[model samples]
Target: MSLAQGRSYLAIPGPSVVPDAVLRAMHRASPNIYEGELVEMTAGIIPDLRAVARTQHHVAIYMGNGHAAWEAALSNVISAGDHVLVPSTGRFCVGWGEMATGLGAEVELMEFGTKTPMDADAIETRLRADKEHRIKAVLAVHVDTSTSIKNNIAEVRAALDGAGHPALLMVDCIASLGCDRFEMDAWGVDIMVTASQKGLMVTPGLGFVFFNDRADAVRAKMTRVSRYWNWTPRANPEKLFEYFGGTAPTHMLYGLRAALDMIHAEGLEAVWARHETLARAYWAACEAWGQGGPLTLNVADRAHRSHAVTALRLGAPHGTGLRRWTEHQAGMTLGIGLGMSEEGDPNGDGFFRIGHMGHVNAHMVLGTIATMQAGFDALGLPYGAGALDAATKVISGKA
Candidate 1:
C-alpha cells in the first residue's frame, strides 16, 4: 500500500520549498501596479537584494526566470561580435553559451567533464593565449545545477589576474545564490545572475542581475542593446516603470520581501551554515545507501559539491524506478538527473538530484532521506542498512 497522500514534499533542486510566510504575503489581492506600496517595495529591496548577493553592485530586476536573467546580463554587456569563454561543467553553462551564440557572440567553450570542476590551469592557459584579448567575457556558473559541481569563482578571478586578461567575469549564481557562500565584491565577480527560486526561497518568475561598475561601463559603451534589455534605465530609473521593464512583478515583490526577511532574520551566514549542515546530512545518508549498491554520489568530493543540490546515479532502470517510487508511493518529489545522461553518460535515466535548499530544516531533510530508503524497499533494491542512522547522526552533530 502506498502512502503518497497528505502534505507532499518537493525535494527538487530549484523552485525550492516556499515558506508559508512568503505564500501568505503573495496571497494578497492585486496591489496597484503603477504607483503605490508595490513601487516603494520594489525600490526598497535593492540594497537587501545586493546584500544577499554579497555585492554593493547595481541590480536590475527582471520579470522572468533565471533564463531571462541570463539574457539580460548578456544583452547589456556584449555586442554582436563579442567572444565569451564558457567553462562548462554542466548543462546550464552550456545553455548559457548557447544563449550567447543566439545573441551573435562567438563562444569559446572549455569543456570540463560533467563531474569535474572547471580547470583553473586550462583557463589561465587559454586566457594567456588570447594576446589580443579577443574574449570579452568568461561566463561560468557558481554551481552547475545539472551535475552538482561547484566551481571556485575566486580561483577563476585568480586565473584571470594571473593572465592579466581584460575579459569580463560573468558568473551565474542561479542555483547557489542563498544556499552557497558567495562573495561577489570580494571574489571580484563582475556580473552575477540569479532568479527568485532556489536559495532565495521564493516562487519562480523573478530574475535578478547584479553588476559592478565595470559591467556598467561595458553597458554604457555598447550601442546595440535592445531598449527593453538595457540596464541604464533599469538601474537608474526615473520612475517605477524603469525599475521593472513595464508593470512590476507585484506578487513576486511581496514574496521576495518575505523570503528576504526570513533570510536576513536568520542571517545570511547562518543560512549558509544551515544549508551546509543539512546538505552534509543528506550526503551521509546517500553515501551509506550507496554501499554495495548501484547508487553513487555523482560528485565524490565534498569540497566540490553544492550545498543546495546533490546529484546521484543508479544503474539503468533503478534510478528512474527510485524517483518514481519516492514520488508516487512516498509523497516526496526528487529532481530528475538533468544533463547527466545521454551525452554525459550512456544511460540517461540513471541520474537524479535532491534539492535541499532554502527553508529546509533537519526534519524535512531527514524525512526525505527516510522516504528514499522506503523507496528502495518498495523497489526491492538492496541498499546498505543504517542509512537513516547515519543521516540522523549528521543532523544531531554526532557524525
Candidate 2:
C-alpha cells in the first residue's frame, strides 16, 4: 500500500517537531570526545543555556531524560529523610513528588487537581505551618503537559517569602523551556530542570539542570548525593569528562546548539510573543467549538493554560475516537488525554489535548485546527462553524 504524499504532523505534547537545522547539525560522525570543537562547543553551551533559563548561574547537563534531571535535582539538594513541599497542578507535579518520596524524602503534596492553578495562599498556609522550616525545598512544574496547566513559580516564591520559609524553589520546565517564558532568576527559582525533547525542538536524550548560588549552598551542605546524580562535579567540572559525568550525548549536543541558535536568532522576546499569539488563537478556536456542547477547556481561566499544550474535555467517550480519526484520516497526531479523568471514569473518556509547541508557526497552527475541525465534522460532534476563521483572525490580529 502507498502512504500519503504530504507531511505527517506530530502534535503530541512532547517529542515535538524538530527543525531542519537541528536535524542537519546532528547528522555527523562522532567528533573528538577528548579536546576539540566538540569540547569547545560543549563549554560554550553553558552561557547560552544560562541565557535560555535567564539565569547567570551554573548548569549541569546529563545524558538522560527529564526523569534523570528530576533525580539529579532532588539528589543534589534534598537528601534522604528530608521534607519537601510539592504543589500538584497536574500529572508531572505528582510524578515529581513521587520521585522525592521514593528518594526517602517526606513529601507534602498540596494538590489543586488538573484543571486549576495551585493557590499561592494555600501554599503559604502550608509553609507557614512549617514553623521549623522542615521543608527543604518546593517542587513546582512551570507547565504540566499532561493537563496543560501553567503554574506560577514567581507567585509561589512570593508565598514562600511571605511565610518566611527557607526552602529551595525547584522548577520542572521540561515542557515550557523554549515555548514559554521562564525567568529563573527573576522568579527566584533555585533549581530549574528540563529535557531536550519538548520546547527545545530536539529529540529526546539530554536533560539539563540550572542552579543558582542558593542551590549550590544546599549542594555543599547536603549529605550523600549519588555520584551519577551529583551536580557538584557536573556543574563545576574540572575536566571535560565531568561535564556529562561520563560519555556525552554528542548528536544531541549538536541538535541543541542548532535549537539554541534558532531561539537566539529569532530573539527570546519574539519567540515568546509568537507562542503567546499561537496559544491565544488555539484557545479562541476551542471556545468556538465548545459553544454547542460540553467540549470545554480543562483550565477554567485562560491565564492558567499552558502556551505549549491545550487540554480539553468533550463530555463524551468519543474523544478518543475523534483523536484516532484525526490521526489516521487527517494525518495529524494529537496528544493523549492524561490525568484529566476521575477515579470512576474510564481511561480519558471525555478528554483530549493539542500540543502546539516548538517549531510550530501560524500555518502549522492553522493546519492543526483545520484537521481537528475536520475530525469534529466527521464524528458528527456538536460544534459551531468558523472556528478556524476566528482562530486565524486572532493570530493575524484582525479581530
Candidate 3:
C-alpha cells in the first residue's frame, strides 16, 4: 500500500527546489552568446547580486558550482607558500582549507568540531600568535550545511581587528547567502563566495566570488594567478566573453536574473525572516519529538543553528529507517547526515537533515513536519506527542 505517487519534494540543503519562474526563464532557446538580451540581463544581475550580499564591492561570475567558487576565490589572493588560517566549523570549512592546500598555500585549521559554531575568542588568540603575519587570509564559512551551524562572520572580522592581523577575511556564504542575514560590507569581509542554488532558488551551475578593494589589492601583489581563475577581467570585463573567460552560461544567467528579481521583489530582509520563521517551526517539531524519543537536534543552541537547514539525530537504524519511510511512503526526500559520522554509527545512519531553505513556505514546511510524524508512526519509532501542535503554533505565530 505505497502512497508515494506524486511530485516529490527534495529536502536537501544545496541544489534546493528551483522556482517555476526560474525554470520558465531558462526554458527558452539558447540566445546569442555574443550580445543582446543575454549581455544586458547579465549587466543587471551584477548589481542585484551585490544587493543580495549587502555589498557594494566587486563580484566575479563563474560557470561552475560552489566548489568552483571556493577554488576561484583562493586562486586570486593565495599563492604558493602563502599562509592561510581556517577556522573550521564543519566539513565545508575543512574542505575549503584542503582546496587552499592543493593550491600550495600553507593551511592551518582551528577545529571547532561539528555541533558548535567557531569560537571568536580562540580565533583572536590564533591571530595574535601569528606575529610575523605570514597568514595572508582567514577562510571562514558563514554556515556549514552538514552540521547546520551558523558562525558569526562579524565576530570573525572583529577577531582579526582585535589581533591587528593583516590577514584577508575571506568567507564562504555558499549555504547562508540569501537564507541568513549577511552584510559583507558591514561585516568587513574581504572576499565572499556563493552559488546560484540553495537560497537563490536557481538550479546549480553558477558560482560567484565577491571581493572588496582590499582583496583585489592582494591579487595585485600576487606573483602569478591562473588566467582562468583570475578575477580582474571577470569583474570588469571589456567584452561579454571576458565576463566568463569564454562562453557565458546562457540559461543559468537567465535563471539567475529571474531568481534575483524574486529576491528583490520580496525584499532581502523579508526573505531572511521567512527562512528564520520556517526554521523555527521545524525546530519546534523536532524539540517536541525529542522530548520522549531518540530524536534530537545536532546543534543544541538555537542561536548557533543555521536558518537554512536543521540536522537531526534519531540514533542508528532509526534515522535511516525514518528517511526511507518518508521517501517511500510519502513523496518527500530528506537530506542525509553529512560529515556527522561518529563512534558506533560510523556511517552516520543515526542522523538526517531537514532543508528549510529557498522557495519554501509555511505549508511546505508544515507538510514536511506532518509527513515525518507519519513516518515515525509507520516505522514504529517512538516520538513525543504534540509535535504537529508545536510546529503549527510556531507557523501560526501563536508559539
Candidate 4:
C-alpha cells in the first residue's frame, strides 16, 4: 500500500519550503500599487534586507529570479570588452561567468572542480599576475547549490588585498544568504546577488542585488548601462514604480516582509547556528550509513561543505531508485544531483542532494534521515547501523 498520503516535503536546494507566515501574508487581495500600505511596507523592507545581508550598503529589488539579479548587477558596472575573473567551484559560478560573457565581457574561468572549495592562493596568484589590473571584477559564489561547496569569501578578499588588486569582488549568495552566514560589508564584497526563494523562506519571484559605494563608483564610470537592468534607480527610487523598474511584485513584497520579520525574530546568528547543527546531524547520519554501503557525501571535508545543502553519492540506479522510493512511499522528496554528471551516469543518476536550509528544524531533519534509512532497507541496500543514533546525538548536542 502507498503511504505517501500526507504533506510531502520538497527538499530541493532552491525554492525551499516557504514559511506558513509568508504564505498567509501572500494570501491577501492585491493592494494599491501606487500608494498605500504596500508602498510603506516596501520602504521598511529595504533596511531589513540590508540587515539580513549584514550590509549598510544599497540594495535593488528586481521582479525576477536570481539570474535577473546577476544580469542587473553586471549591467551596472560591466561594459563591453571589460575583463572579469571567475573562480568557479561549481555550476552556478560557471553560469555567472557565462552571463558576463553574454554581456560582452572577457571572462577568464579558474576551475576548482566540484568536490572542493576554491583555493584562495590560486586566486591571489592570478590576480598578482594581472599587472595592469585588466580584470575588472572577480565573480565568486559563496555557496554552490549544485556541488554544495562553500567558498571562503573573506579569504578571497584577503587575496585581492595581498595582490593589491583593485578589481571589484562580486559574489553570488543566492543559496547562502540566510541559510549560511554571510557578511557582505565585512567580507569586502563590492556586489552580492541573491533570490528570495531559497534562504529567505519566500517563493521564487523577487531578486536582490546589494552593492556598496565602491561598486557604485565603478558603475558611474561605465559608459552605458541598460535602463531596465540598471540598479541605481531601484536602489534609490523616488516613486514606487522605480523600485522595480515597473509595477511592483506586490504579493512577493508582503511575503518577503513577513519572511524578514521571522528571520529577525529568530536572530540571524541563531538561524546560522541552527543550520550548522542540522547539517552536522545529516552528515553524521550519512557517515554512519556509509560505513557499510555505497552512500557517501560528495564533499568529504566538513569545513568546505555547505551548511544549507548536502550532496550524496549512492551509485547509479540506487540513487534514482532511493529518491523515487522516498517520494512515492514516505511522502518525502530529495534534491537531484545537479551538475554532477559522470562518465556512465550522464544524468547524474548516481547522486542525490538533501536540503536542510530555511524553515527546517531538528525534527524535520531527523525525520528525513530516518525516512532515508528506511528507503535503504526497503531497497535491499546495505547500510551500517546507528545512523539515527548518530543523527540524534548531533541534534541533542551530544556528538
Candidate 5:
C-alpha cells in the first residue's frame, strides 16, 4: 500500500537537497562566536559568495529568509512615500510590492499573470509614462519559482535606461542565483537579493543582498532606515560582530562555506550547463507525457521557462493525485502549483512543479522521470510512450 522510505527527494523549488559535505560541515558543535575561526571564516566566505553571485559589490549577510532580505533591501532604499514599480510574473514579486506598501511606499503593480513572463515592452511603456520619475526602484524576480518563468534582468535594465529612469533595479534571485545564468554587474543589477537554500546547496537561515555604488548612494539619501536592517555596517563592518549584528550563525556559516566551495569546484559555467542539460531532459519527458493527456507546461515557450524549475498543469485533481502517488508510492516529492488560484485559473488544483536545481544529477533526474511514468501507468492515465527514452537520449548526449 505504501513505500515511502529511504532518502526521498525533495523536488520543490527552494530548500533543495543539501549535500552531505554541507551537512557534515554544520554538524560540528558551536564554534567560538566572539573571534578566531568563526570570524576568519566569515571574512573568507563573503567574497566567495560574491563570486557565486557574479557581483563584486557590497554584500550584506542577513540571518533571515528571502522575505527578510526583501525588507532589508526596501528599508535601505525606500522612504515613507517613495514610489516603486513591480513587474510581477508570479505571486512573490507582488508580495514583495506588498511588503513595500507595508513599509509605507506607493506600489505600482504590473501583474503579468501566473503563466507568463514579465514583458519588457510593457515595463518600458510604464516607465516612459512616468514623466516625474517618481518610481525610485523596480523590483523584479529573476526566476519566479511558483510559475517557473524566468524574466530577463537585462531587459528590465534596458527599459529603465531607455526611459532615462534612475530607479534602482532590485532583483529577487531567490530561486535563480547559482542555477540560472545571472550576471549581476554585467546585467546592471543594482540590488540583488537571494537565499542560500536553493542552488547554493545549503540549508536555509541565510539571506544575502548585494548592492552597487548607485544603490549605496540611494541608501545614503534615505532619511529613514532602521538600524537593525541597515546595510552600512553589515557590508563593511570594522568588527566581526557588526557583520551579523551579534553572535553569528555558527553552524550555518560552516554549511555555507562548504556549499560555496562546492560551487567553485564545479566551475560556475559548468554548473549552469549541468542545470540546463537536466532541464532539457525533463522537458523532453514532459512534452512526451503531455501528448496524450490534459498535461501542459504553464509557460508554453521553453525559452521563458526556468531551467531550475518547471511548472505543469493537468485536469482537475490529477496534479494533486500524481503528487500524492509519487510521494507515498515512489518516494518522491514535487512542488505544488503555487499562485495558480487567481481569477480565470479554475484548474488551480491541476498544477504542479518539478525542481531540478542544485544537488541534482542525471541519474536522479532519470529515476524521477521513471517513477513518474510508473505513476501514470499505475493511475491508468494516458501518456505518450518513450518518455524515458526521450529523457535518456537527451541526458546521454544523443538528442
Candidate 6:
C-alpha cells in the first residue's frame, strides 16, 4: 500500500518544494507591470539579495533561468576571443563552458572527474603557466548539482591571487546560493550567477547575476555589450519595467520576495547550518545502508560532499530499480543520477542522488531516507539494517 498523502513531496534536486507563503503571494491577481507596488516592492529586494549572496556588488535580475544567468554573466565581462579557464567539477561546469564557446570565447577546460572537487593547486599551476594572463576569467561552480561536489571558491580566489593572475573569478551558485555558505565579495568573486528555483525556494524563470566593481569595469570596456544583457539598466533602473529590459517576470518576483523573506527569517547562517546538519545526517544514513551492500558515495571524501545534494552509486541496475520502486510504491521522488554514468553504465543504472536542499526539514529528510531504505528491501537489494536509526539519531541529536 502506498502512503496516500495530503501533499506529494518533490524531493528532486531543483524546483524544490515551494513554501505555501510564496505560492499564496504569487497567486494574487496580476499587478501593474510598468509602475506600481510591484515595482516599488522589487526595488527593496536588491539589498536583501546582496545580503543573501554576501555581496556588496551590483546585481542584475533576468527574466530567465540559471542558464540565462550564466550567459548574462559571460556577456557582461567577456568578448569574442577572450580566454576563460573553466575548471569543471561536473556537467554544469561543462555546460557553462559550452555557453562561453557559443558566445565566441576561447574555452580551456580543467576536469576534476565527476566526483572530485576542483584542485586549487592544479588551477594555480595552470594560471602560473599562463604568463601572458590571456585567461580573462575562471568560471567555477560553487556546487556542481550533477555530481554533488562543492568546490572551495575562496581557495580558488586565493590561488589566483597567489599566482598573480588577473583573471575574473566567476561562480555558478545556482545550486548552492541559499543552501551553502558563500561570501561573494569576501571570496573575491567577480561575478556570481544563480537562479530562483534551487536554494532560493522560488519557482524557476528568474535568474540573478551579482557583479563586483572589477566586473563592472570590464563591462564598461565591452564595446559590444548586448543591450538586453547589459547590467547597467537592470541594476539602476529608473523605471522598474526596464529591470528586465522589458516586462518583468511579475509572479516570480512575488514568489522571490516571499522566498527571500523566509530565508532571511531563518537567517542565512542558520539556513546554511540546517542544510549542513541535514546533509551530514543523510550521509550517515547512506553509510549505514551501504555497510554490507554495493551502495557507496560517489565522492569518497565527506568534506567535498555538497550540502544541497548527495550522489550515490548503488552498483548497477539495482540503483535505477530502487528509485523507481521508491517513487511508484513509496511516493517519493529521488533525483536521477546525472553525469555519473558512462556509456557502459548509461541510464544511470548504478547511481542516484538525494536532494536535501531548499524548504526541507528534518522530518522530510528522515522520511526520504526511510522510504529509500524501504525501496532497498522491497527490491531485495543487499544492504545492512539500522539506516533509519542512524539518520534519526543525527536529526534528534542522540548520536
Q: Please name the candidate that would achieve the greatest lDDT relative to the true structure.
A: 4
lDDT of 4 by residue, 1-399 (tens): 988998989887878999999999999999999998999999999999999999999999999999989999999999889999999888899999999999999999999999999999999999999999999999999999999999999999999999999999999999998989999999899999999999999999999999999999999888889998889899999999999999999999999999999999999999999999999999999999999999989999999999999999999988889999999999999998888888899999999999988889998998899899899999999998899999999999999
1 or 3: which has the higher lDDT? 3
| TM-score of model 4 (CA atoms) | 0.99
Expressed as tens digits, the lDDT of each residue in 1-399 for candidate 5 is 677788798888878999999999999989878778998999999899889889889999999999999999999999989999999898788889999999999999998988788899899999999999899999999999888999989999999999988889999999998898999999999999999889988888998899999999999988878988999999999888798877688898999999889999999999999999999999999999888877788888888989899988866677888898999997999888887763555657778889999999999999899988888888888888778999999999999
Query: Could you give the C-alpha RMSD of every candidate to the true structure, in order shown?
Result: 1.3, 1.4, 0.8, 0.8, 1.3, 1.2
Across 122-153, the per-residue lDDT of candidate 1 in tens digits comes to 99999999999999999989999999999999
Candidate 1: minimum summed lDDT over ten consecutive residues — where? 339-348
**Best of the two (3, 6) by lDDT:** 3
TM-score of 1: 0.98
TM-score, candidate number 6:
0.98
Pairs that collide in candidate 2 are none
Question: In candidate 2, what are the lDDT values of residues 73-108, reduced to their tens digit?
Answer: 998888889999999998899999999999999999
In model 5, pairs of residues that clash are none
Model 4 regions more than 4 Å off: none
Steric collisions counted per model: 0, 0, 0, 0, 0, 0
Question: Each model's C-alpha lDDT?
Answer: 0.91, 0.89, 0.93, 0.94, 0.90, 0.90
Number of the candidate with higher TM-score, 4 or 5: 4
lDDT of 3: 0.93
**Best-to-worst ranking by lDDT:** 4, 3, 1, 6, 5, 2
